[model samples]
Target: MSNSGHPKDHGRRRGLMLVLSSPSGAGKTTLSKMLLDEFSDVKLSVSATTREPRPNEVNGKDYFFKTQDEFRAMIDRREFLEWAHVFDKYYGTPKADTEARLEDGQDVLFDVDWQGADALHDQMPNDVVSVFILPPSIAALEERLKNRPGSSPDMVARRMEDAKREIMHWRRYDYVIVNDSLDVAYQRLKRILLVERLKRLRQLDLEDLVRGLLGEA
Candidate 1:
């Protein structure tokens, strides 16, 4: 390890795909933002979508907005690592840019739902480190949805229903975080990323380093 105590500081390594999934009102998005702010090497994977951008959403920063025809063309070209039809819209991860980033040793973070997470793992199982975030309780989740800016009663009800289905897939993830306390959950998320980054298989120069240590170099 180098001065930073990170194995990546000492050797070259392929970066990981960190998949974070949760229901709409859960804290996965918040945790993802915290991780990105903390780790300079990690970048968010901007997805391509057919949905209309919400307020304050940017074109490339939030999502690559595409028409239905454009999205279908991309699908035909096999340009997506994974794609899913969600909530009457198409959403996908672009393959080329994400692969390039991984090869350059930059971790990509995915803030997706369970369907997207499943699709990503199916396509790139070895590279994916999946985490599922859960609300502490259903009541808490309802409160969160209701407290959202401009949240209506119908929208909250619909999201609550979706949350129940999403919570059932928690067991599929490598790690599960109950985001009762934002600080505690963020720390756990950071620890997971750090430990995963230090795994032996991710250290590309380990073989040479070990040989030198044993006087074989």
Candidate 2:
């Protein structure tokens, strides 16, 4: 927990988990990166994966890439908040690290898919705020996919097909933003985070503040 207005109350304030989910090429990754860069208090949750790192990915920066056996062992021990196999690769968010950050009052950001978002919400409904990002149109989404490196015609078509199913989960999210413009989408995401952070239930010491205001504490 975190105390927004007072100090010396180390155990009083807690943090929040903000999740942003979108299909490939919808600009969720770009928006998350920009939000992290702008918000000093926000920390990105680096997920653990069984997939090998991409060309520019760093060991601890992009993800904690692990072998299949290692990932499976964690699963056996129930160490993940949520785990899923996507495109034949395994991915999971470590439960301990996320809980620790929240207890310490540092907001955590998750760029995950719908399944993972649902799992987190089930585990921590009050602390989780999910947002779904949509591309302006399927045609625009296809164009973005085509422009990405190593993307083939077949891959683009498959992504477009998958995107339709993913967008159907948009209603499951607390907020939805259409990525027509990166700048506008980023601002909307920022606003969402800012407002969520201010929710009264999230601030553990709010009772004291309220009573003080009324001279009744």
Candidate 3:
């Protein structure tokens, strides 16, 4: 079975890929956590990484940690939906795991940059719904990056420069959220997911569901 496209809806709904991208200081990470915690059916796409696991990180749950050679083999085999090199390490979404979850009717969430989002959408245009989070202003984004714990002034400056470039890709997203307030932006994000789940393309089985109610199915 193909892992990156729509599966048969059958009697149940097919899952969707929710791709959330933002600059470093935006509230996308926090909002994604909220969705996972609040929704029982939503699952985080645990990535495969070539980097060493952190002190408290688990191998499978946090990330599928692998050697560089192993990662490259998967890449060569076309096993990743999207993969990237970052900070000298490789990270990717495993096609098998993601596809299994989707076929089982569970929503999968992706916390990726615009490049990764674009790649995933290209591979699974029908299944993917991309959202770009924005700060109220660049100054606000700078302040956020600077205020982060353990963030040095130099680091914040570099991130601010990167954020400028990131914000330029806002037009590529299917939806955009201006994160003026964390709570409000989160609400908007939730609404977008709710509506997207109800989309006719995603809810392909809804026709029979409605027809059955009318005794015509």
Candidate 4:
């Protein structure tokens, strides 16, 4: 680890893999959008999926839609950083794009579940910072799911059941934010990102600062 308060000069500035995981109605998606909009250096990693796009969802912007066979082919080719089956649809983060972004010293944001977050950390241990969002209560979660205009009663029930399972993995993440209010949750998420961005280990250029302070060339 680099000195906590000092700067370094040897290595290039490192990138961060920020994973935001939450249950279906926990407000992670909303928080992610806020972070993306607020941070100019952060890039959203668009996942590839086998599921059909929803209304107003662009193919490459929202997700890279692929046929099941194409997705499987990528899997066989080892093109994904992490891939998983969710609700019978294949979803994956393409390895090349994420690497390229990191190499350019850009932070990548992932809005995925715990399984995906774990897989990402396994692949890139040093770069990842995982956060889990929580609803204030199960009742609030159920109400949020039910209030979504496009969801049917059965869909809401299914999400609630899945939420319980997802919430069980909360302890695995580095930070947990209980989203009681959108504005408060967004601010908390933003703060986490900003603090992590300044971590000494992530700022490899600190070596120079240390050397300079010691009067070394």
Per-residue lDDT of model 3, residues 128-193, tens digit only: 999999999988998888889999988998998898888899999999999999999998998887
Taking all chains together, the TM-score of candidate 2 against the true structure is: 0.83
> Which residues of candidate 2, in runs, are more than 4 Å off?
1-13, 50-70, 86-89, 211-217
Instruction: Report every candidate's CA lDDT.
Output: 0.89, 0.88, 0.89, 0.88
What are the models' TM-scores?
A: 0.86, 0.83, 0.88, 0.83
lDDT rank order: 1, 3, 2, 4
- In model 1, where is the ten-residue run with the lowest total lDDT? 1-10
lDDT of 2 by residue, 43-112 (tens): 9997999998999999777898999999999999999999998898999988888898988888899988
- Find the number of clashing residue pairs for candidate 3: 0
- Top lDDT prediction, candidate number: 1
| Per-residue lDDT of model 4, residues 1-217, tens digit only | 2223333234666778999999998898888877777666788998999999999999878899999999999999999999988899998999888898888888899988888999999998888999999999999999999999899989998999899999999999999999999999987887787788778887776888789999995
2 versus 3: better TM-score goes to = 3
CA deviation > 4 Å runs, candidate 1: 1-8, 50-61, 65-70, 86-89, 211-217
